[model samples]
Target: MEASKIRLTVPEGIDPSRVLGAGDGVLRALENLVRAHVVARGDSVAVSGDPDEVELVARFFEHAFREADAGRTLSADDVSRCLAVLRDGEHDASSLRDDVLLSYRGRVIRPKTLGQKRYVDAIRSSTITFGLGPAGTGKTYLAMALAVAALKRHEVGRLILTRPVVEAGENLGFLPGTLEEKIDPYMRPLYDALFDMMDRERTDELMERGVIEIAPLAYMRGRTLSDAFVVLDEAQNTTPEQMKMFLTRLGFNSKFVITGDLSQRDLVGRRGGLADVEKILGRVDDVAFSHLERADVVRHALVGRIVEAYDAYDDVREQRSRDRKESR
Candidate 1:
């Protein structure tokens, strides 16, 4: 057996002594990043077994050397931190694709951002997943994508999408039309995401055939969903009891993805189901939760900034509320 070797191309203006810091410490840290790569040719590093791992090692040295040439001091600990990030795929450009791509309808659907990837993975791996984040972060979109993929793969018999029918500031009873027509506006976001993943005509056909079902959270009670992918979008508006009822409906082989923006809950009362679920089920092992920050917003660039602005406002408002209570 022979030990693997990694060839390093010391670029001009970067002193090798600076990288090593006049000792073997930096060399050892670099060795950990190299793991199993072998020098196949000058300036090229190769590793047997996994191409992904080899590329990871190659990228670390590339970034490390660039920092060294810029007169930035590189300690062994810094090198270790860089390797850790790379190993976690933070620096890998294709990390999002590797995590979220699913082949469906003869096309590949990949999440546009890291938040979307985490949301999809959580839905797949856990019996229940909560995608809590600001608007435009793909929480609803990825959940719909997962539901479509599950149906396409025959892993589930049907797809059920629902949301609370809470009106922001209006009375739903005053709205004309049948129950379904009145509630359609609230469920539009869920429908839009579904339409994007599946052809509109085909989606219409499925809805008519009951293969795909969309309704309000009120309709989910007294039912057990077996072999189904159930997504509750905009769930923050659900009352705590409603949220509990939905979770209990998870039957054999069914997966549930519940997505909401806590700050936007329209439930009026302080006991929204989405918030309660986060507090109660957050510690459960088989349930996964992904909280997306403004950085994970993958919509229009402006949307990310808007999310951040709202977050800052909310933080200030919350602090003021706390201060008022304490003063009393």
Candidate 2:
């Protein structure tokens, strides 16, 4: 069988650097992904391999260049997503690439996966959004970015970040520290996300002025938060009563994002608040629930595979449990 070849011309006035990425990293990634030998010359990229592989490779570059032409810098994550689309034989994803949610300092924050795009859209169109997924799915991070953007745009009067300190479990009384000190560890992720979106001095200033508030979930009790962008992280640790209290606290002109991984809940012998809330409020209007799966894990490449492995294990265990129950 003879090898097939396709050459993609670099459009004038479009930076090849953006399409190729730094040091040809993007090209290399594509080469590793597709069964093709890719070469970049003066003003074109050549893909040579099997006829079928060549066609897919061509489409991949074509999709990526469209994004580059539209002034979006393509990263490894973008390349990975494009590869996934190609393998899945999905149609064009140019719309996903074009939807820039937020830009901070020189970095643009956009959804890298289809699930994440839906998650961000839900946050924008709904008064309450639930991002339920495993780690590295951008559940909390994207919610934080959206919340910060809303506050920066003056769409809301304040930003409130809170999470339950359930890692201590029932032995919380033994923790030797004041209330603030005891909860600081659980709230560090929220603080880190805030600092990522705002400078330390500005974040501190906002905290001092009450424009940005970071506190434990207990701090949210009995307070009606109005005109605020509120995010309750690690909601899986909250009890059903706590979840109801938090949900009822949403006031006029306010948006709430409740994010948690039900699989990672630490609420000993009790159902996760997020799970209960999902069952109760799923059909309610103005509330959206977006779920990200293993494919949405945007951390290291192995993280997605790790999630899949654990999911497989859980399925087997569940089957055994069901079989034993039936036998009884």
Candidate 3:
């Protein structure tokens, strides 16, 4: 057997050190993963070893260079993810890396998973998109990103972020603070996402000018939202009537995103608004439902396993109940 060698010229304007990673850590990681001797020189990377290993290394960096060309700096996590995708052959690196949506303060926001990519696409193409999934799937976060992008592009006049506050487990009037203070906790996630995409000063300015509205879902009643981007988060907490009211509030030239986790609904003793509306309008034109499963979870790796475990438990519990009924 003979050693095969391949070299890749790093693209100009992309720091070769970044492509290879800080202190050549990324090169070492790639070398260890692909069983190859990786070397990086001025504006070029060379791979030598087993022919197959050399080929894998070449293909892996090829994808990495493509990502760099697309305005993405390679991170250690990205290196691992791209390597896995290349090995598994389920999806290409370009699908995971291209299309920079928003970049703020050195943070590049784009879909980190395939489901998120579909959810983003649904928001772009449909008038209403339901981001149905478990926690950590970037459902609400991605919707907020898209809303911010639309606002910046002037595709919409304003941004509306609302969520049902049922999860508080406390009555609103009894809370010690004012209405804004009372609802702040429930709306914090939306605010966090917004601030992540925009500076605090600008976010506050937009909110003060009424260009961005963050309110409890109750406030959406009797108002038509025109030329705005609206995101209804934690939608599983809304009653059917509330959902209907919110849906009807969608005026012309607006985009609406509804995100929820069906398993985590806090609504008491009645069907959740998200589930009800999904059944009723699921077949309607220009409305999309992008369902994300445990595999789409982008949080700490354990979260996906946790979601899968809970789903399996629920399945067994349901089967046991059915068996008990059959015995009767």
My TM-score estimates for the predictions, one after another, are 0.71, 0.84, 0.79
The digit string of per-residue lDDT tens for model 2 on 10-80 reads 78988898889888888888888788899998679988998988998888778877878878677766777
lDDT of 1 by residue, 7-126 (tens): 567676667665555464665666666655343233333444345655666676677566677675566655554555567674442434443335335556666455566666678789
Residue 250 alpha-carbon offset, candidate 3, angstroms: 1.1
Candidate 1, residue 215: lDDT? 90
Q: Candidate 1: which stretches are off by over 4 Å?
A: 1-93, 99-108, 323-328
What's the residue-level lDDT of 31 in candidate 2? 84
Evaluate model 2: give its TM-score: 0.84
Alpha-carbon runs more than 4 Å astray in model 3: 1-61, 68-92, 98-103
- Clashes per prediction? 1, 0, 0
Query: Whose TM-score is greatest here?
Result: 2
lDDT of 3: 0.84
- Of the candidates shown, which would achieve the greatest lDDT relative to the real structure? 2
Better of 1 and 2 by TM-score: 2
lDDT of 2 at 326: 100
lDDT of 2 at 230: 96
Where does candidate 2 have its weakest 10-residue lDDT segment? Answer: 95-104
